[model samples]
Target: MTRTALVVRGGWDGHQPIEATDLFLPFLRDSGFEVTIEDSPEVYRDAERLAATDLILQSVTMSEISAEALTGLRAAVAAGTGLAGWHGGIADSYRNSSDYLQLVGGQFATHPSTHPDARHGEASDNFLDYTVEITDLGRTHEITRDIADFTLHTEQYWVLHDDLIDVLATTTHPVQPYHPWHRPIVSPAVWTRLWGEGRIFVATPGHSPEVLQDDNVRTIVERGLLWAARSE
Candidate 1:
């Protein structure tokens, strides 16, 4: 059976939802999935449309989705449809909606910089080479099947997440003079969880278009989508 995907892209323009999603759409199509792109969250309200979809790729951030739309989406996932997203587009999206947060399983907090002034000045310059460490690798999961440890220059996410997430990769944040926290923190970079029979995959990279286009980042995301959409 040919799989179908709903690609919803619209929210904070800073995240470049439109441009970043454009990169992934062709990838999905080339992978043999029938793809549909929607700019509005209205599609979430259509139960029939959502129920027919095999996967949902959301790039929305910091926007409020209607309760009806939220309800329909939760129902679809619970009934075994897959959902996947990245960074603020998914993890930091719809802050007011606890229901959305509960489903996605994490919230983006802060990316403490090497220079405190990086946030106001040129934060992109502080985008250092960082490695995403494979944490729990014993499970024979398709997402991390042949994937090895990789490095990227992007905004590493410090997320507040649930224990239910099967953390596939993590990055350690060492306490530096700039950050006086004095604690070694491990942040989850990639993770997967099952919500009912449905699969959900989230990667906390892709802070910019360049990051999304990175070879390693692209490969991880591609595998993530496939893993999320995989059926028993």
Candidate 2:
């Protein structure tokens, strides 16, 4: 059977929701999913339309979702549909809804100023190289299959997570000159969770367009979407 996917994207323009989603379309097509792109969050409330979808790719961030819409989404996932997203698109989305947070499993706490010492520049200017370490390899899941340890020059996420996630990869930020308020912190960059009969996958990287274009990052995300959609 041909799988169907709904790409719901909208919210803060800073993350380039539509643009980032464009990069993943061909991947979804190549995987044999008939992709439908929606620019608004209203689609979440259309229960009839959502029921026909096999997977939902949401790129919305920091937006308020109506309780009715949020309810429909949770129902779809619980009935075995898949939900996947990256960075703030998934983790930082629908901040007002605890139901949404419980489903996604984590939240973006902060990206401590990268350049705390730059007297004349923005703290973001201090952003530097960071690597995500792979942990809990025993699962040997397809999402991380053959994926070797890799590093990326991106804003490593310091997420606040609950124990429901099956963490796949992590990254560490040693106390640096730019960020002295905290000690060494290890953060989960990739993780998956079982939500009722559905599956959910989230990756904390993809802060920049270039990072999302990386071959490794792209592959893992592609496989993750499929893995999350499968009914086990």
Candidate 3:
């Protein structure tokens, strides 16, 4: 049977929700999923619609979801619907909702400036050359297997997460001479969490359409969407 995948996108135009999500349409179709698109999180209010959905791909960054809509989304996922997203689309969305943060198992704290002396107003301030290191579990996990450590010159997310998540890959933020921190900080770059019978997959590397199209990032996200979907 064909699976149903819902794509909810809108918020923070800086992330280019439409263009980013568009990159994956062909893959979803090729994977035999009947795709549906909603421009707002208001669609989450339709509990019945969410119930029938096998997977949800959210791309809304820094947006708000009403209490009713948030409740419905949690219920759908708790009842076994899968959830998947990348970058701020999932990790940094709905900052005001603590419930949403707990459900996703992580939150974007900040992306440290690349250079201590760099100006804050420009985009390049947060863009840094970093490496995503696949963990031992990632080497064997379906979502990251055979994917070697890779490097990217982009925004590397520094997330605040809990032990509930199973980390697949990580990126480290080094301590610059100008920063106050003494130790290097490591953050999860890719991860999955189990909530009830549902599955959630999050990747923090897709800061733009170009980053999402990277071979490693694209492959992992493709596999993650399939892995998170409800069982047939």
TM-score of each: 0.93, 0.93, 0.98
Best by lDDT: 3
Q: What are the runs in model 3 whose C-alpha is more than 4 Å off?
A: none
On residues 106-136, what C-alpha lDDT tens digit does candidate 2 reach at each position?
8988865555445356535635578877785
lDDT of 1 by residue, 13-131 (tens): 97899999889888889888999999977789999988889899999988889999899888889888899988888888889999988998888888767676555567575576678
Whose TM-score is greatest here?
3
Residue 129 in candidate 1, Cα distance off native in Å: 3.0
Candidate 2 segments exceeding 4 Å error: 119-126, 177-182, 230-232
The positional error of residue 195 in candidate 2, measured at the CA in angstroms, is 0.5
Number of the candidate with higher lDDT, 2 or 3 = 3
lDDT of each: 0.84, 0.83, 0.95
**lDDT, model 2:** 0.83
lDDT of 1 at 54: 88
Model 1 superposed RMSD (Cα): 1.9
After aligning candidate 2 to the native by TM-score, how far in Å is the CA of 219 from where it should be? 1.1
TM-score-best of 1 and 3: 3
Residue 61 alpha-carbon offset, candidate 1, angstroms: 1.8
